[model samples]
Target: MTEPTDLTPSGRLPVTIEEEMRSSYLAYAMSVIVSRALPDVRDGLKPVHRRILYAMRESGFTADKPYRKSARAVGDVMGKYHPHGDSSIYDAMVRMAQHWSMRVKLIDGQGNFGSVDGDSPAAMRYTEARLAKASSFLLDDIERDTVDFQPNYDESENEPKVLPAVFPNLLVNGAAGIAVGMATNIPTHNPGEVIDATLAMIANPAIELDELMQIIPGPDFPTGGIIMGRSGIRRAYETGRGSIPVRARAEIEEIRKDRQAIIITEIPYQVNKATLQEKIADLVRSKEIEGISDIRDESDRSGMRVVIELKRDATPDVVLNQLYRFTQLQTSFSANMLALDDGKPRTMGLKDILEAFLRFREEVILRRARFDLNKARDRGHLLVGLVLAVANIDEVIALIRAAPDAATARESLMAREWDASEVVPLLELIHDEGNVIIDGKVRLTEAQARGILELRLQRLTGLEREKIQGELGEVAQKIGELLAIIESRPRRMEVMREELLAARAEVATPRVTEISDALGDQTDESLIEPGQMVVTITRDGFIKRTPLEVFRSQNRG
Candidate 1:
């Protein structure tokens, strides 16, 4: 037997185990940071979210169309684009549909999509969904080569790297994710405000943060609440990191002759109403809070309303303050503002994000213009061939009759030089560079010959001929416009502004969360209601508070 050659040349390089582990861990961490967790700066979506929208749009599940089963969309995304678990993909889809979760809902869900009270959404098999109308702004012009595409997991299809997001979706809807060692917690802003800020930045790239803050006051949560102060907003906008305090909107009113109750119309964003009520009840039972006699959730289709009845002598203001201190009714949203920029994690302030989006939008507009320009030029080239053939209709028909087969006639049409005097001007008008006029004569190209031979008998009529000429004229006009847009920078910016305004009309809405100047100044002592309580201590140094009624008065029992 022939000696076996060294199949594994050089074998292993003898890398240290420490080095291997370090390098492998870094690769895994980067994969999580770039591909799985962070949102893209342009489209403000993770891979799973992007895949769902693209798959739904591809499947014709749009706003105008009727809703399809959510399971269908999830399956398409998982099979075609994202190769992840169905539960994770469905969870991402469900969040896009929840109004309380997203500032501007991207999906129009037809069935139960969970609630702010921490209820779980229905299974994907039971729900139906379609792309929302506002999604058109993000998905429009996608097929016109506005963005880059790469092969899917199995190379069976291509998927867009980032959407052609016409507006700043990141700021409008916000994002939240946890990566290997970093996390993002961006707060949502008003659409109108975000658009106005973008337009303002377009008008003046050097605008300061204070001026931007004037336009965009603060985050506008879908669940309307009161922001305690503006300092946090300023700090976040300036540094990309800060905590904003939010409080539920509560009003004290007399429910009966002398019984007063606290009415909660809106809770802090992401807070569960049921959980808040339970906590209040626990506090009341433990005597840590003294005022509330009863608690009930009266929420309905109209709106949210949670009533906390006060004792006859309890002060409404103090009791409300105590509840705010101890319950989820008041919470702080910590803003991290981390996202993926150019395939790397970055911490960006407001200005950085807007600047990046503007740059990307300009690139999309340029790419789309080039694509449309190419299409128009190709169409104009075909029309030129038709105009030439119509000018020489008798010669062309006689030549076709003389040839035995269509291929022979096509070859003959390509071989002979025809008079270019009539069609030269049309070619010049469309700037066609395919066939050059030599001594006032030109030869037909393969494509042009095919277009000519494929013409119908009806097209030989005077009216049909004139219609073709008119269409050629329109295509030429479009070509000229697209060329101008491609050549001029200011003109491109103008187009961007126009498209942004159009998107604004569909996305803008009135602000929901109100910003207040009042400082949150409740102390720990004030958090406890003024009432009698029993404190218990164990040998292990554990302490607990119990209501005084736990031990009833008795005679040596």
Candidate 2:
């Protein structure tokens, strides 16, 4: 071998290529596993989001079972899927099932998990559960090949990095995660709309994102309230960042024939129910509002019923306005639509989500379109072969088997000039065979061969084809919808993505020192009077090297 050449200059120490290569490769691998693959505490999931489903499944929470302890469900998930602590697992499961926590809760519980007090859930042994109809619906195809699976933390178990997650949980249920230098926070969404969007994405490979948004509108909270405006929703969807103002619902309640109380039945989620109750109590205590009667928790298993009894001579509307103004009873639901995209933290507005979903929708379309096109091409090729085989049936069988190769048989038939049309059907028959090929016995007519090609390549009229077409239409629609989002400026995710990339860029920059060269400008001004030092500070600027010479005496002209 020739002598090894030195990469470094003569004065510099020799650097081995292997050491540098090892360090760089090691860094990339660690970054992918820790920042992209792992789940955060907010979701309380690991590689698998199984606890949410497993807890519901184990708690006897079947669509048929009576509602039971959410706590027990949590316990099972912790013991089996989690193998971590009990509290957080139980809490995550509860949140996934809670109407208050989710825009559309996937689980339906019959018993108490915990109140809005943010109290910890009970131990798993004390709780019980079963699968909800919704959970079962989502998990319907788990056994089928609709999704892929990989090994769990240990080789002993297997986990799904993602379930079929067919509804696009990233947009519907939303998500939040934090890694070393990244974090994601996505908002909740409506199930009906999300399902519609998912179906749309599956159909058309080129649906516009804007069209998709028309179906989704914006997030529909489970509390059954309203988002104050459309503009913010649009902004959030486009830019992946925006907030919506939300208000609590209140109505007049009659205690007696003449006495009335302004009762608050529902409060905005993230609004403190107990605190609102206390605030009202405090109002009663402070005599800020002259309410004549009692304050009691009439809330029960059915729902929240806050009874605010009033004096026979009270003004309900005025007090309602004040409550709305002062409390979270009516507050802003800040929709900081943020989430993880390709292993980085990103903030999205509604438009951003719409745009991202649109892009994803188109990708699925392209994949399906390619699949369909290739399928059509195969039938076209077979149609040609069958035509040739049928024309000269006798010689074809011998040629097919003894020739030992498809290409050789094809060559032999082409040279013979006997009926090329007949050979086409032979090719087709071989392709459709359940058992054997080139048997020579299978026969066909020119009309029959033409008919098969027409039927196979023409797109099927069968139920499966119709279903696939419908899905294609939906995906196409979504692609169209997302494209429309571009008009709405949907692409907040791009902004967030840019920010994360900028952060990464900063990481690559040298961080040795930040010494200001302006320090040399310092001049002794100790004799200057206190509060009269006459300092000329560089206000509202950076790289502020305030040279001592730059400062002028307060009295200096």
Candidate 3:
């Protein structure tokens, strides 16, 4: 073998291990940030999510289409787009189908898709799925080239860089993921509220965060609960990070004579109800909490009802407060609104996120219009060629007959000049740049010439000629509208607003979590019933209390 060449051809360059590690780690972190952990501010999807939706769409698993096997979808996504594990892709698909997970579900599942109780979904083979109706908001204009696409990992397929989402899905559906050194946990909001706020921002771009908050007071979890205060919500909306306390909605009900029970109707967002009940039971058994007789889940198909039976003398309010303090029934949802904006990780406030989405939507609309405009112009150009062929029918026929072969005929047709009088208005209407008018004459392009040769003898009739003009007129009108949309910014904004409102009408539901001004961590002393008690104090610093009703009643004569 030849003498060993230098590690570097010119010189042996050395890099410290620390530097190499740092660079390698940074690359990994960025990959997770861009491809796995964070969602795009525009479409509110990470790479896996976007791929799954796109693949399902390509396979014809739309809202109107019948449900297909979940395994089939997972296989298609993994093979074509997402090269990750099947379980990860299937889990993402299941979450999108879960109503309790996504505020507006992207998938419409036909089988068991996990639960708020923290149960895992059945395997992909046992389930079925299709895109949800509201998913159309994100996928409708995709075929019109509204978004950019990039090659897959193996370059065997192409996937969208981001979806052309019409609604503010980032806020409406929320997101949660953990990357290398950073993580994001955004809370879901009411679709109606998010849409209304987006419209407000569009109408007045200068609106402050506080004004926007008026339209969207706080997050609305799928599982109905109560948000205790506004301070945390305000902080999260303004700074993109905060913790909001949520409590179970409970009521004191007298099941029998003097015994009362706490009926929990809803739990905090993301808190496992089964775990919460177990914790409550543990508290009672360990004697950490004093006032409890029994605990049982009376929840059914109608609604959730966790009944905590109280002893004869136990105060229901005091016991409820203890449960809230000790169990997951009252939990704090930590909001970290970190997302990928322009391929960079950004912790964005409410206004920043909405504005980014609006800008992206404007770009998508403009690009789609341009794509349509190009198609319309191409059609009009071909129509002009057909019109020319029909007008000079005999000359064209004679030329074709004289040619020795098809190639010669095509060249001869393109070589001659045709009168531009009849189709000049149609060309101008479509802004057809393909057909150039020079000195009151136009030369047929190879494409137009080919189209003329392909035309049948029947198209040379009077009715066919009239049909061609009518079709060209329609194409011209479409071109004009598309041009108007592309040229005017305010018109695009109007279209965005209209589309958003329509989506809101379809997906908006009542706010499940109720917001209150009262603090969640207040003492339970206020819950104690007002009464008189006899107190006895010992010299050793011990004290005891007895209800006034414990003493015998007396009458004064």
Show pairs that collide, candidate 3: none
Clashes of each: 0, 86, 0
On TM-score, the candidate that comes out on top is: 3
The C-alpha stretches of model 3 lying farther than 4 A from their native spots are: 1-13, 524-557
Q: What lDDT tens digits, residue by residue, belong to model 2 across residues 297-325?
A: 77787877777777776667656655665
RMSD of model 1 against the true structure: 5.8
Top-down TM-score ranking = 3, 1, 2
C-alpha-based local distance difference test score of model 1: 0.92
- Native-to-model Cα distance after best TM-score fit, residue 373 in candidate 2, in Å: 16
Query: TM-score of every model?
Result: 0.92, 0.54, 0.93
Please say which candidate is ahead in TM-score: 1 or 2: 1
For residue 189, model 1's alpha carbon misses the true position, in angstroms, by 0.9
Q: What is candidate 1's lDDT per residue for 315-379, written digit by digit as tens? A: 89889998888898899999899988999899999999999999999999999999999999999
Which 10-residue window in model 3 sums to the lowest lDDT? 548-557
